[model samples]
Target: MTMMSLSWSLVSIANKKQQQIRRFKITIHRLFGFAFLCSISFFLFSPKIPRSPNYHQFADMRNLLGVPNTLNVITNFPFLVVGVLGLILALEGGFFTISSQAEISTWILFYAGILGVAFGSVYYHMKPDNNRVLWDTLPMMVAYSSLFSSLVVERIGQRIGLGCMCALLFAAFTCIVYERIYDDIRLCLMFQLILPLAIAAVAYMYPSNYTHSTYWFSSIGIYLLAKLEAVSDKKLYRANNYVISGHSLEHVCLALIPFLLSVMLICRERKFKRLGDLKDQL
Candidate 1:
């Protein structure tokens, strides 16, 4: 009887520990959500950020084989490659280890956005001007929105993920429209930065359901590198002796993100499940 009572005491302690851990996780998640809302509120209420007058100007303005901004135009082909391949594998279902329609659908939207990037970016590079810039920015913003939504679906539940996705989609659309009408890119730029930061935050704070989460981390690193390349386009072009520009390299770096995620989908397995544990606790 004494041995049995001691065992019971240990079991009680473990259960209480699990309960405390669960509550702590919930509190942390809520705090992160609140902080995000505050940051977004600041962006919405802040002043307008206008697109630069020289936004169309890109480094490496070479016209090779009758192609204007040849490197820039050619670089977009990587988006088409990964976008199409990712869409195909995602649609086939069996090709990836995905277990639910929700995630599959999110991936479909993400790949679709990537494909749009290919066409929109190509068109914009062919004749970059204020008039054509909308096509370029819109598709990329859509891709970013889809990316953030995909990570939400992975870390959070399906219902909340889907809801956030619709909200984010609407946010992306509104920002683009605002940019076009008011000639302001502030909201759009903020969302771009916010989404990636949120991605890293979620990855760090939330427990992942699937394996290969390191891919997401590495992808974000790739994104930062791409952004740096984009900002230093002229310096990179001069450094490379006019062979290739940083903007072109940026496209390549950005394209690697989707490819990395796609590889994750193909390789990852469902690791742990909370449903059974919760049911047992109840």
Candidate 2:
């Protein structure tokens, strides 16, 4: 073929490829936009959902070896241990490395939230009231929102991720505060349910720079198991002759999740160079 014809053919192929890439990105953006709008609509239209009257009654109430709610209360200690460990790792820069200061701040917030969960959960299990439940759930929301934001930052872009993290945290706190004032939990429930699904979708859809992405899936699995155990708390207590309960196991599983995530961060490495360095590397 003539050189001019060959050159024209190559340019046409490159343009077509670029168009395809642009279309793909636009499609992804549209999908996310639709999902976001649906979520906001649900929150705005949902009716008030009050706390269940029997929500505070947990299984494993035995004063085992003179400890009240021994299994339930004791299992919660893992959260504190893991939380402290996570904080130490974050402070020591033992987790994954990031070039951005914003990313570092995000990690600190996430670890701090984990630490707060330790105290808040213990307090809630000690007395198990709506008032105390607030403490337990508030910190949990913080951790959830932070983790979601971190995933966003990693999968998406830095500025967009930071913005999302801030927006999500604000939404979470608003739900908690609104619940406290109005005795409604619909928004909180929506946040809890939607965030995980969104995170999972992001994990599946995006390319990760870090290894050990499976740890995110594992954490999600453990979280689902914990929820199942919590739901079956009374039945498990009865089946086990009151020695232990599903709720106790749930606590253990929940604690392990953050620990697993921390290990993932510590073990993971970037698979690619920074965006600006890509041209140099090429």
Best by lDDT: 1
How many times do residue backbones clash in model 2? 0
How do the residues 1-282 of candidate 2 rate in per-residue lDDT, one tens digit apiece?
455665575577557645644654675588669867877787688766789868888867777687666777778788888888777777776455655666666777888888888889888887788888989898888888888878767766577668878888899889899999999887788788878877787777666767889999999899999999999999988998877899998888888888898888877877655445544544
**Which 10 successive residues of model 2 have the least lDDT summed?**
273-282
Q: After superposition, how far is residue 225 of candidate 2 from its true place, in Å?
A: 1.0
lDDT of each: 0.83, 0.79
- Candidate 1 residue spans exceeding 4 A from truth: 1-47, 273-282
Q: What lDDT does model 2 reach?
A: 0.79
Instruction: State every prediction's TM-score relative to the real structure.
Output: 0.83, 0.82
Question: Worst ten-residue run, lDDT, model 1?
Answer: 273-282
Count clashes in each candidate, considering only residues at least 3 apart in sequence or on different chains: 0, 0
